[model samples]
Target: MVEATPELTSTSDSPALAVSVLQMLRTATSVQHKALEARLPLTHADLDRSLYTRIIEAYYGFHVPLQRHIDQFVSPQACDPKRYKVAALIKDLRALGLSDGQIDRLPLCCDLPRLQTQGHLLGIMYVIEGATLGGQVLRRIIADRLGIEADSGGEFLDVYGRDTGRRWKAFLKQLADFDQPEYNGDVVDAACATFASFERWLDRAGVLL
Candidate 1:
């Protein structure tokens, strides 16, 4: 789970029935958030190249199908290319010595959560965009412990690079449009489902802590 930093949790300027979407998402998905964080091995002190690669591999598998699915709903104005992380994951895999062919041969997650509306999509995006934060901490850990750098096999850990904050804020700004109470259920369900899906996928891939 991505840490719920203040930036991600601050109350939106616009209150939808006196409760911001951030607040609802944070409160409702707290349990699922902690569960996934506890199970992910990214923070383990002994994280090695093999273990790290497995983790990235699992993420690549998840995002390949996920990105394709989500693109269908995101409008041109809302679809920021920088928000996409699959390419970064692929770059890291290549730096780790995987050939393009091997990457193409990699398996993808099939049982993704259903997204019926843009509200559900927002919840899904919230989870995905929020996870970028863990990368900031991960970059340092992998650098000190595994001798990996963004240009090497750790690009995925710091996908947004120096602009992570800008990207996150952009996502938050986008969320402002869905602050209404009516959208709350889909947002929370999608957020929880995303965490569950990612954790279950990693566990199935044998990469969980």
Candidate 2:
């Protein structure tokens, strides 16, 4: 299981909450981030269909419960429910030729952290949404490596397609609007936990190439 550092009790006097949260997550989760980047199949130059399928399977395992909780806990006003990535994950898995039963049998990350509040939901959203920014780059790399496209096995990484930037900016604007000193610590803690959880999930799913 992934463990986050002890939570801070307060962040009332911190600098801009959104900026601080983002920076704190980047610094605190850097090790996990690098480990995943180094080991994920997409990072390798000699990627193959099997490796790509494994990567997608890992993603499916992590995203299923995460997205479920996000939809359950976060307000639609704060984030568009339609923008959730699980659908893309499922589409990609299907495109990879996994039968329903096979996909059902894929290992799931059952140790996902509880998301109990809007702040917690936002924090999780921060991690998943931020992934899309990197996904833009990964999409291109996967295309070059595996000859995949948005409508094919690349659905998850190619989530936003040409709308990635606009979608990200919109989410950022919404995040900025919801920024509150009282919830700052929760947001940061949630983001960090999300990263750690994802790292652990990937490790468990055997995505280390």
Q: What tens digits encode model 2's per-residue C-alpha lDDT throughout 79-176?
A: 57668788888888888899889988988788887688777777787778878888988989888888888777998997988888998888777677
Compose the digit string of candidate 1's lDDT tens values, residues 1-209: 53443323334784434667887788777778787777787788778889888888899999999998888777667777877889999999999888999999988999787788988899999888887787798799899998899999998889888988898888898898768878777888888788888888988999887
Clashing pairs in 1: none
What is the TM-score of candidate 2? 0.83
Candidate 2 Cα outliers beyond 4 Å, as residue runs: 1-20, 75-79
lDDT, candidate 1, equals: 0.84
* lDDT on C-alpha atoms for all candidate structures: 0.84, 0.77
Q: For all the candidates, what are their Cα RMSDs to the real structure?
A: 4.5, 5.2
Q: Which residue pairs show backbone clashes in model 2?
A: none
